[model samples]
Target: MDRKGILAARVSVFIVSICFIAMGIMRNEHFVVFKKAVKICLECIGLG
Candidate 1:
């Protein structure tokens, strides 16, 4: 594709991803992910 077409595609994809992230945040999914990450880290270090 041409440069303009590529730019438009990139912008559209970015907007869609931002929307999904916002939706996840609204549902409190970020905290759940953070908790899981912390748990995994603790387990890896034998503290969980």
Candidate 2:
């Protein structure tokens, strides 16, 4: 590929990697909040 095409490809890959990493971090946070929320909801429903 030409230089510009190669550069664009590299940039796209970098962006994708960064997005994946960010989502992974957010996923962890989401699970933590999700677990707590589920517990609270269950208690409110008198199942816990």
Candidate 3:
């Protein structure tokens, strides 16, 4: 990948990780919306 592509990929992964972490916290706080979002993130990350 080119430098720009690598940077974009890194940014994407970082954003995804942040989303997952936020969802996890929301889940712990009893937010149903976050639970679904977390599931989607897991699938996207190939962990679901």
Candidate 4:
């Protein structure tokens, strides 16, 4: 992509990430995320 398109893409990624973070914070979803991440990590290590 061109310079402007590249910048827009990067900005969009940041905006979407921020939105998800805000939603998670509002719903206290991040707490559950840790458990899910632990499961994922365990599966990755072939221990799950």
Candidate 5:
């Protein structure tokens, strides 16, 4: 593919990913992910 087509694909993918992320945030999935990550880190440190 040419440079312009590659750039357009990249932009479209970015926009789609942003929309999915926004949906996840609206559903509060980010907090759930953050909690899981924190739990894993604390367990690794023997704090949980």
Candidate 6:
């Protein structure tokens, strides 16, 4: 795509990311998901 199209795509992605983060924070899902992710990582590394 052209410069304007690329800029628009990046802006939309940033906006969506921010909105998702805000919703996760408001609902406390971020921390819960983080905890689960860490657990999964540890298990994958054979340290769980």
Clashes within 3 Å, all models in order: 0, 0, 0, 0, 0, 0
User: Which 10-residue window of candidate 2 scores lowest in summed lDDT?
Assistant: 35-44
Report the lDDT tens digits of candidate 6 across residue range 1-48: 999999999999999999999998999998998887876587678886
Give the whole-model CA lDDT for all candidates, comma-separated. Answer: 0.93, 0.85, 0.81, 0.89, 0.93, 0.91
Q: Write one digit per residue (lDDT tens) for candidate 4, span 1-48.
A: 899999999999999999999999899898898777766586678887
Of candidate 6, the 10-residue stretch with the lowest lDDT total is: 35-44
**Candidate with maximal TM-score:** 1
Score candidate 4 by lDDT. Answer: 0.89
Among all windows of 10 consecutive residues in model 3, the one with the lowest summed lDDT is: 29-38
Off by over 4 Å in 2: 29-48
Model 3 error, position 8 (Å): 0.3
Higher-TM-score candidate of 4 and 6: 6
Could you give me the TM-score of model 5 versus the true structure? 0.70
Q: What is the lDDT of candidate 2?
A: 0.85
lDDT of 6: 0.91
lDDT of 5 by residue, 1-48 (tens): 999999999999999999999999999999999988865587678886
RMSD of candidate 2 to true structure, Å: 7.7
Span of ten consecutive residues with least summed lDDT in model 1: 36-45
Question: What lDDT is obtained when candidate 3 is compared to the true structure?
Answer: 0.81
Candidate 3 runs further than 4 Å off: 29-48
| lDDT string, candidate 2, 1-48, tens digits | 999999999999999999987897777976776778876576678886
Candidate 5: stretches off by over 4 Å: 41-48
Candidate 6: stretches off by over 4 Å: 34-42
